[model samples]
Target: MRLFGRKNGEDDSAERIAEFWRWWEGARPGLDAKVAAGGRDSLASLAETLAPAVSALHSGLVCEVAPGRNAAHALVVTAAGDAELRSLAHRWALAAPPADLVWEFHPSRQANPQAADLTLRAGDYEFGVGKLVLGLRVPRGAPRVDVSAYHPIFSELDDDTRLDAALLALDSVLGEDDVARWVGEITAVTFQPIDAVPAVHLPAVVADLASEFDGEQWVALEGKTARGRPLIAAARFPLRPVDHPLYDQHLAVTLPYAGRDGDKLPTGASVEALRDFEERLTRVAGDWVLAAHLSAEGHRIFHLYADPAGEVRRQVEELAATWGEGKARVDVAGDPAWSAVAAFIS
Candidate 1:
């Protein structure tokens, strides 16, 4: 039944689940508050009864949530010790495979045919898995699963199992075309697939590919396999020229921009700005290097490839702050060995 951490006379699993509910209900205010505060003891008490059911699911359970829904911070931990115990609400649903599972996202006090129609809020967004409604109040025209970076805990099954978890996760936000486009972009079936290679040999493949496609255009679109099995990236960059020496040349020289007091941001920007920011960066720094593209999900990413100099680091940091808080990161590399840093925007 439940995996008990220690030999406690009382049901530890139940206690943990109850603790989870308390945290979940408190996560978003409004009606959730009533459920979280009013049913604290009872929820914990019910956890004792549900412990056996909850433990039947997956092993090494972990739940990752954006701290304060900050989007920039992704906090991850095991189910038992997570900061957002509220995520336990989906334990029952996540344990089952995609086919056997049924869920919904509804917050109103009404009966539905859905199995786990539950609701929970993360940041200002509402997440509904199955029949569950995560957020009590939905923002004006906010698409479901608006915030990126979430993984559904699926049971390990046969390789033939083509469960599109990414598509389903944000079905509320994405249309069929959108989902298809994303899947197509990330899991391009046109690429060749090899046999089940050794796990230890992945680094070698990456290294070889990096060397072969050094001057070529490429992006690790999705760090996942085509058949939902583990996969690596081999897609070549299609937008830019291969011999672009901008990124590489910049890696040779130390940065020149540093030491800013107030926000040293570039002026004149709007949502409809026709100029591509990535292209702008390339053009601005064009004097020393060739052009390059930023990652696909470039919303909150920080892309800076500077030389291996201490002063470069400081300048890059200042640039990131000035350019508005994005997914801040810095990359520095010598001829072969490349160094990198990356941060996620919440």
Candidate 2:
């Protein structure tokens, strides 16, 4: 049997395919007349013969295949004779199959005007393809034709496969020269990880706190500032002598202060006070404060992994005296041992 308009004994060469497209391009205006004169059998014959090739090309274009249908359908969006083509397609669809093959010839002007006069651009073709969309744009001048392939049978395939299929489809429709140009104009897509807050370490204070607690553990804390910058710190807590080293420590602190409106710490004097506080704690307590934050509530919270109980009390007293009383609070895990251990360590 003949396939894709090829005669049983006809030459099946790439050159022949090119010739067919060229002929179709030139003779497209008269196709409706030809079909009308050819009658139902001729249309069915055309559909049957073109089905495989059209389906293949569509698969390549969309990187997908329609499910449950033996025939392939295409939607050609163009700036040429769109209304006439749509009417012709509608008239054709009214007939019963095997002549009832589905195809659409649309004018981009009536649909997406942006795509109507689109030049050769490189980006993802979000439309046209049903699911396995290509990430390349075919170069076409104004008053040009753009093809879209659709299939209902869905399977999730990788990007590379879909792209390859798209290129192959382009090769069939626009031929190798056009496909090569498209490939040259193609752009790549990339992904990035979300930004993270920087981490802080305070070994000396951690060691001092470890000495007071039966056992001690440390953790990293992360949050965001009002302006969306990262806020990170380290935390320490007490563990019982019999507790496993890996056991979770409940004692911790969350730092910095923000305004009620989710604003960062005041830019001037408040900033100075915060820096001075960090420096003082480092000097007196051996850098136990991993990090600090100014909360939206106008409170400066300090995150500490280790605090000798007595030293923490003394630091709090001194900080209140300097920065104003009740302006800050130290958060620790609520355990009697955590409080008791702090008492003895300081």
Candidate 3:
């Protein structure tokens, strides 16, 4: 189910990246002249040529030309908001020519909230970004925002086209990376929901909310497992998986307790012991996040995320080996999306 173009768990080829950069440097000059002169034929040729060069890096990657912040035109090679492909776009950007009077490079679409007249077309419908309104809902105890959008023109298109248009407009304003990182679920609404706000104001709203998620706050929940067993779970209240993208490894430390009470929950003494172990483990597991934990079935599981480069997994393994509280089973794997413990927050 992986949607990104890089080979699963494999590094993208360096020589391939060099080849594309080599091609771009040679082709950029002529393309720049014709593009600046507004030559339609040259624009067509540039698009066709650029597609393969970018695809050579990753099939899922996309590129385009736009007015630039650093120069007259920007070559924006982007991940189109797919978080997994961001690194590919970044690698391409790193190899790009220096920004000059006519050229610049962008790894992702930069936000342009002041494009007051920004308009987009999809299917058979066209709408102004300013005319769009958004319905935002942050689940009472959850970490993300779910958005519903409305535009007068949505009435003219089918559901699929309507959603696509809404997304494209949002992506243009917020930039693809932020949209992918911060936004959860987005759908098109037929009518403005209860407290819809103007799309132009969305940038500020998202910024304010993002700042809150960046804070330190944690919450715990008690429930029953699907098998009707008692369970206790805890995690950072506003758990943002993309907050630290480099921490792509998932580590699960399972400690079976002989101290479970009648209800299959931890006894008082076991709870204190588990907490101390977590504090010590966390201190040594540099750049690690205890994403979530589950206490059920006579065992307490500590779900974690960490940067492999920090030797976090090795450090944690060392701690687990010397533990006196039953044999600790530590499992580690690649999960950049942090899907393993998402249920605790969701």
Model 2, position 26: C-alpha lDDT score: 58
Taking every candidate in turn, the Cα RMSD to the unseen true structure, in Å, is 21.3, 28.3, 4.1
- Ranking by TM-score, best first? 3, 2, 1
Off by over 4 Å in 1: 1-220, 225-276, 286-318, 325-327, 331-346
Backbone clashes per model, in order? 31, 25, 0
Alpha-carbon error at 98 in model 2, in Å?
95
lDDT of 2 by residue, 78-104 (tens): 212122122222222232123124333
Best by TM-score: 3
All candidates' lDDT scores? 0.30, 0.34, 0.77
Q: For model 3, what is the C-alpha lDDT against the true structure?
A: 0.77
lDDT of 2: 0.34
TM-score, per-candidate, Cα-based: 0.20, 0.23, 0.80
Output the lDDT of residue 141, model 1: 25
Over 4 Å off in model 3, which ranges? 1-44, 71-77, 81-107, 124-126, 137-145, 181-184, 190-196, 211-214
For model 2, the superposed segments whose C-alpha errors exceed 4 Å read 1-264, 286-294, 307-310, 332-346
* Prediction 3 TM-score vs. true: 0.80
Model 2 residue 173 lDDT? 35
